[model samples]
Target chain A: MNLEGLRVMGIDPGLTRCGLSVVQAGRGRAVLPVAVGVVRTPSGDDLALRLLRLSRAVGEWMDEYRPDVVAVERVFERGNVSTVMHTAHAVGVLILAAAERGVPVHMYTPSEVKKAVSGNGRADKKQMTAMITRILGLSEPPKPADAADALALAVCHCWRAPMLFRQRAGLIDGRVSAAKRRTPSPDNHDRSFPS
Target chain B: MNLEGLRVMGIDPGLTRCGLSVVQAGRGRAVLPVAVGVVRTPSGDDLALRLLRLSRAVGEWMDEYRPDVVAVERVFERGNVSTVMHTAHAVGVLILAAAERGVPVHMYTPSEVKKAVSGNGRADKKQMTAMITRILGLSEPPKPADAADALALAVCHCWRAPMLFRQRAGLIDGRVSAAKRRTPSPDNHDRSFPS
Candidate 1:
C-alpha cells in the first residue's frame, strides 16, 4: 500500500479539551505536520451544548482539512468512570462526524500510539511530546499535552496504516496465517520505530 | 408553568438496541402515548457505522415527532464496563442530536424513572412494565423490555417536569431555601402515587 501523501487526522477526544491534528505521510519514515490545535468546551456548560460545540468544531476541521482517514485514541475503562464517560462521549461525536463525512475512522489504543511514535509503549508525556516535536520537525513542542498527543496519534496511524491495510487484505482474501489469526496482544515494548 | 399538551421523547440509549418513545402530557396525571419503538444496529458492524446508524434513526424521530423535550436514561458506571461505554456513546449521540435540533434534553437515572412511574425506587422490570401499561392506558404492555423502559422514562419525565421546573426556577431566582438547596436524595421507596 502506498502511504505517501496520505493525509491523516488524529483526535484526542475529551470534553474539556480535545486535541486535533492533521499530518501527511512523506517519502519514508517522514511525516509532515499540516495543522494542530485544540478544541475546548467550558466545564460549566450543559453536556448537550458542550457536545454540540465540540461537534461543530470538529466538523469544521474535517471540512477544512479534508483528511483521507481519521485516527482517534480509543477510550479505555481504566480511569475515573465519569471522566471515561465524558471522553467516550467526545469520541462518539468524533466518530459520527467522520462517518458522516464518509471518511474511514481508525482507533488506536494509547499504548499503541506511544509505541508507534516513541518506540516505547510506556513513554511518558514529556517523552511523547519530545518525539512528536522531533518527528514533525516543529520549532517547539505542541502546546498542552493534548496537542502533542494528537500529533503522536496521527504519526502513529501514518506509520501503521500500511500494516493495517495488509492485515485487512489478508482477512478479506481468507489467507490469514496462524500468526495472523491470533488476536494481536500488547507487549511491554515495541521497537518497530527507532527512538 | 403549564405542562398540558407538552410532548416528551424518552430514549433508552444502547448500541445494539435503543428504545425510543414519545408521550404527550394531558391535563393532570393523564398521559397519551404518541409513538413507541426501538432502533436496532447490527452488533457486527463497525462502531462508527453503528453510532452513525443510531444517530440517523434518533434524528429522524426528533424531526418527525418534534418533541418539546427529550428525556434520556442517564449512563451509570455500575454495569459491565464495555456495555457502559457503548451505552454512553449512544447517549452522547442522542444528546447531540437533540441539541442540534434545539430540543432540550434531560437525563434521569434508572432509579428515578422507576420511582416516578411505580412509586418505588427499587421496582423490578415486571412491576415497571405493568405500571407503565396502566399509566399509559395501553391495551397490552409494550413489547421488549427496552420499549417498556422507554415509555417509563417518558412518563417519569412527564410526572417530574413540574418539580424540575420549580427547582430550576428556584436556582435562577437565587432564593432557594435550605431544603430546596440540598441535593435531593433518593429513598428506598416513594408513594407519591398509588400503585
Candidate 2:
C-alpha cells in the first residue's frame, strides 16, 4: 500500500484569507481541519508581520503533524497586480517555511484542484464545497473559499497524485518534469545543484 | 548519474534587482554564468507590466535553461517595512512562474548561504563575493549585488549539499528517522503560529 498512514498538510495560501487543513491518508483519506483562519492586516498594520505570523503558523503545523506531503494551491490567475504580488509574498513565506525544513513542496493549479474536488474541472466554489464535504464526509461546508481550496489540494494529492503516499514526496518538478510525467519519471528529482 | 546533466536555474528574487543564473548540473558539473541583469521597475512604471516583464524574462529563462530545479533565495530579514512587503510580492511572482511549469523550487536563507560560501555565518557582501568567486573558480566578480547572491545560492547548494554526499548538514531535529521518518523541516523559514 503506497499510503498506509499518510498525513497531508493542505494550504490555501492567501494574503488576507489563508486556510490550512490537515488530512490523514489511509485506504480512505479524511481531512481533519487542524487549523483554519485568516491573517487580516488592517490599515497601518505591518504586512511583513502578518506574513511572519502566517509562516510561523504553518511551521507549527509542520512540527505538530509531521506531514509527509504539503500541497499548496498555485497562485496562477489572480487578476489584480498588487494583490497578486501580495499573494506571491505570502507564498514566498509559505514556501520558505517548507523549504527550510528541507521538505519538498508541490503546487497544484486551481483548475486541477477544482477538478479533483468537483469532478468537473470548471466547477464553481459552491460545487467545490459540496463535493469536498461529500468526499471527506464532513458535517458542514469547509467555510471560506480558501478553506475549500485547502481541502481541494489535499483531495487532489490523495486522489490525483497518489505517490505522495511516499514519505518524501519529492517535488513533482513543478514544471516540465512534473507536467510531462504527470507521474514520477526517472528524472523527477535531480538534487545535483540544490538550494 | 541520477542528475542526468540537469540544468539548475538560480534566482536572486527582489523587487528592484531580480538576477537569473543558469548552471548545468552534469557529471562535470559545469557552472556557466549565462545571463545576469536587473529589472528596474523605473519608479513609476506599471508594477504589473514590470512583473509581467519579470515573469516573461523568467519564462524565457525557463525556456532557455530547462532547469531541473529552480533554486531561490529565501527571504531572511527585511528591515524596511514597505520594502520588505514589496520584495515578498516580487518573489511571489517568481514562484508562480516556476509553479506554472511545475518547476521544483528550493530556497536557502542569507545566513545559510553565507555560511556555506564563506565559512562564516555573518559574512558580508565583499566576503561573500570573494568566496563565491573562489568556489566557482571565477576570475571576475559577478556583476550586480543580487546576481552574485543568486549564483552564490546555486554554488552553495552544489558545494555544500552535494547529492551524493551522505552527511546531514544542519543541527536540529535529527532524532526523526529518514528511514521511516519523513521530517519536512525547513531552516530560517521562521514564522509564528497561534500556538
Clash numbers, per candidate: 0, 15
Q: Candidate 2 residues A1-195, lDDT tens each?
A: 456466777888776778887777655344444544444445354454555567667778788877777888776533775566567688766766665565556788888787655656788888788877776777788777877778778777766555443333435345643554565554322111111
Q: What C-alpha lDDT, on a 0 to 100 scale, does residue B25 get in candidate 1?
A: 94
Tens-digit lDDT string for candidate 2 (B1-195): 244356677788876778777765434333555555555555465344455556667878788777777777775333665456556656766766676576777777888777766667698999888766765667898888888888877765554445323334322345533532354533221111111
Model 1 / residue A21 / CA error / Å: 0.2
Q: Please identify model 1 stretches exceeding 4 Å from their true place.
A: A172-176, A179-195, B172-176, B179-191
Superposing all C-alpha atoms, what RMSD in Å does each candidate have to the true structure? Answer: 3.3, 20.2
lDDT of 2 at B130: 78
The CA lDDT of each predicted structure is 0.89, 0.65
Name the best candidate (by TM-score).
1
Q: Where is model 2 more than 4 Å wrong at Cα? A: A28-39, A163-195, B1-195
TM-score of each: 0.92, 0.47
